[model samples]
Target: MTGAPPDVSIHHLRAITNESTVELPDRVVEILAAVGPDTDVLVSDVSARSFAAATRRSYSKQEPNLVPFINSLQALGDELVLICQVEHGDELVTAVVRATDRSLVAATAIDRSVGIVHITVQELCARLRASNAPGVELALEVASQCLADDRVRIFEQGALSTARTVLTKYTMAAEKGFDVRGLDGFAGALVPLGDEQPGFCIVQADTSVGITAFTPGNADVVAAMGIGGLSLHSETTEETG
Candidate 1:
């Protein structure tokens, strides 16, 4: 039993120019600003149970169809889908687009290549604001079925699964430090807090010690640990901030 399926809501959003004749909603503008450009974006609302199950499966060798699961949200309510490629690092921010009160939603980056993301929402808006292009009014049922079929080809290939696994490890490393490293199915590096940071010590996979992040100019912090120490942060928030 992986877990329960998450209750998902699907929203369809399209890019509209700032100078477009149509009036845009504040929610749409804010999301566009946070996400920026480049990379495709998929919006969905899923039950915490389903999301947890998917997250568990993500750690497994088998791959799960994320977009298909997202598409399934269409039938629950109005379907609003925005397809944009979010850049690997910077443009990968996620948010929740509601019917009228759109707000930021915490998202865990799954497969960045295809922009597969997870969000929990109870319902979605009936329509989007300030759209001058076609494809914004996709039928809920049609989009769901089409996405289900398309996800099959990708799942069979297994690339998405592999990517998700590596990315998940990377996220864990950055957040929880290298202590989470060396666990089964985890493969990644200990990145320093900054380009020229000195407090962080990079350790190799074969070594027993784990790598971690830290603020620059904190050699004393590293010295106190005596070589195998993995410092995730320093006393000051200067670099961490």
Candidate 2:
């Protein structure tokens, strides 16, 4: 199917509920009747329950730079796919995120139309340190896949907090090479390198999974210091965090 969205029938649109109604843009709501009653659909934003208030500032909306998602319950048709799986245009669009308490909780995305799907800090960090757990490897694999698409964009989140990103150059081409399949986009490779102890490192390989050492403006140091990798392309360079 070329990974692009396909034409969905009218019999598949899911309605939005109070729980996951945040991402539903006004435009998406306007198109609901267009999909017909039976159209298939999916939703990838917001949850019946709130995400854990784990950010540096839980008042994310107050700080424009800290927000993760922007919309809720708004899709054009019945068969809307936010991340090729997260359904949109449906009332049951709330996504379940693994909470810190070991129970599944609902978390919403600002915009589920594209980019990487968040697996949650608890799940991601644990998996990244699991010795040989497939979760860490899978995250790397998705990041590797993203660099291939010319339209993709990779942005790293501070492994710990909402700090600005360090590396600006991210070249995953054959010269340096990567080994992953079904990459979501360039955004995947932008690993979150936190400055906390046990910094991130980078290991080269046909399919080797390693850490990425990163410090703001020290992209060059990652080489000698055995740290995380950085993004490439001068044009992509911005003071973006």
TM-score of each: 0.20, 0.23
Q: Which prediction has the highest TM-score against the true structure?
A: 2
Quick one: RMSD of model 2?
A: 15.1
Model 1, span 1-241: residue lDDT tens: 1112122232223332243443334544555555434423432333333333333444223224334333333332443222222223322333323323232222223333353322111111011112221222221212222222222110111122222333444456547644332322221111211112122222221222322222232212211111112443422111111
Candidate no. 1 TM-score:
0.20
Error of 2 at 162 (Å): 24
lDDT of each: 0.27, 0.28
Scored against the true structure, residue 12 in model 2 reaches a CA lDDT of 30
Cα lDDT for residue 156, candidate 1: 11
Compare the candidates by lDDT and give the number of the best one: 2
